[model samples]
Each structure stands twice: as structure tokens, then as C-alpha cells.
Target: ERLHSYETKRANLQAIERLKDHLISVQLTDPSSKHRIRRAVSEIGKRLSSIRNLLRDRKLELDCAVNAAENFQDDLKKLQKFCEQTEKAIQLVESATIFVPSGTDLDYVRLHEPEADEVANRLEKQWKDVFSLGEAVIDEQFGIVSFDTILEILAV
Candidate 1:
């Protein structure tokens, strides 16, 4: 609605310009009448120019705001997906380790220790990557989810 109003005002300004042009083309015999018309045209032209500039500046500001919002949302989604993947990986490690007791079977432990170690290494790498992503989000001022909240989730 606001945009429509701006456009309407702009159209009116253009019409005013055409009228001013036609007025200027008219041959006026009185010096005072000519001077008055010229002064009015100059004032109206300055005001129209000012209005156009204001609209342009406002449009640029709106565009920048929209782009910033989109970038922030994209960053947020990326961070959220990374966190979910990391959580699933952590759950997998937990579930894998839970079934192995202290003295259940030496053979089973021996068979799975290498695999467990590999999982552990991968989990560590995942943590490092998640940390880096968190830092990047924070540095970019998009840290809507606090590190403490993330830490609490990880602790669970």
C-alpha cells in the first residue's frame, strides 16, 4: 500500500513537470507574471528532485535490510543442520558404547576396540567443526542460540 502511494506521488510529479514545461512554452507579455511562473517552477522542481532522492534512498535501505535478513536466515539454517548432524553422530557413539560392559566378553572388546577408537576420532573431529561453525555464527552477530544452550544440548 505504501509503495503504491509512492508510485502515485511519483506519477503526479511527472505530470507536474509536463505542466511546467507547457507553462514555460506559453508567451507571457508581463515581466512580473513571467518572473513569478519561473520562480514557482524552480521551487517545484527542487522539491520534486528532493522527493525522488528520498524515495531512492529509502528503497536502497529496504533492499539492504531484506538481504541481511535472508543471509541471517541462511546462516541460521546451516548452523542448525550442522548441530543436528553432530547430535546424531554423538548418539551413535553413545549407543555403540552402551552395550559393552566392563567384563562381558574380552573377545567382543578386542574385536570392537579399533572401531570404537575410529568412532571416537571422528566424533572429536565433528566437535571441532561444530565449534568452528559456532564461532563463525557468533562473530557474524547471528548467535541467536547461545553457546551455553548448545553446550547444554550436547551434555544431554
Candidate 2:
């Protein structure tokens, strides 16, 4: 909505610029008419200058706001992906199943030990990553991003 307004105003400003140029080039013979035209043109020039300055400032502000919003959204997407990957890791660890034959208990234990240790290491790494992401979010984006929204995504 704001963008649309800005575009419309910018177009109007351009049209006014063209009209001002046209006015400046107009030929007038009478002294009073020429003086009035000159005064009107001068006033229009001042007003247009002020409007241009205001619009430029507003455009810069809007651009900054848009960039901030995009960055926030990118952060949220990264957090969401991390949450999903963590959940998958947790589920995989939780659902791990081991089977051993009755007479081969010792052999099965020897074979499973390395895999179990690897799983443990991966789980530990994922936990640390999740913790780090949480801390970073709290420290950096606390005021800018919505706390409850972040929490909800984390909980998922």
C-alpha cells in the first residue's frame, strides 16, 4: 500500500517536473502576465524541491525497512530449518532399534558399540547446535523478532 502511494506520488512529481519545464519555456508578451507566470513558476519550483527531498528521505526509510524485514524472514527460515533437522535427529535417535540373536550376544554388542557411539556423538552435536541457535536468537534478535513466535517455532 505504501509502495503504491510512493509510486503514484513519484509519477505525479515527474509530471509536475515536465509541466514546470513547459511553463519556463512559455513565451509571454505582456509585462503583468509574464511577472505572474514567473512568480508562479518560482513558487512551484520551491514546492517541488521540498517534495523531492521529502520523497527521497521517505524512499530511503522504506528501503531500509524492507531490507530489515527480508533479513528477519531469512533468519526465521533458518531457525525453522534447524528446528526441523533437530526434530528429525531426535526422532531417529529415539526410534533406533537393536536386535541380537540368543547365542550371539557378545558378537552383537561388539558390532553395535561403534554405531551407538557415533549416534551419541551426532546427538550431542545437534543438541549443542540447537542450544547455540537459541542463545543467538535471544541475544541478537530478541527485540526485533517476536519472542513468542520464535518460541513456537522452537517448540515445534
Model 2 RMSD in Å is 10.8
Q: Give me the displacement of residue 114 in model 1, in angstroms.
A: 25
lDDT of each: 0.60, 0.59
Error of 2 at 60 (Å): 0.7
- Cα error, candidate 2, residue 26 (Å): 10
Q: For residues 31-117, what per-residue lDDT tens digits would candidate 2 score against the true structure?
A: 666667667766766886797789789899879868865755665565555565555555555565783223343444455445544
Residue 74's C-alpha lDDT in candidate 1? 60
Q: In candidate 2, how many Å is residue 135 off? A: 30
Q: TM-score of model 1 relative to the true fold?
A: 0.52
lDDT of 1 by residue, 88-148 (tens): 5555556675464333344444455455445444544544564577433344334324545
Tell me, by TM-score, which candidate is best.
Answer: 1
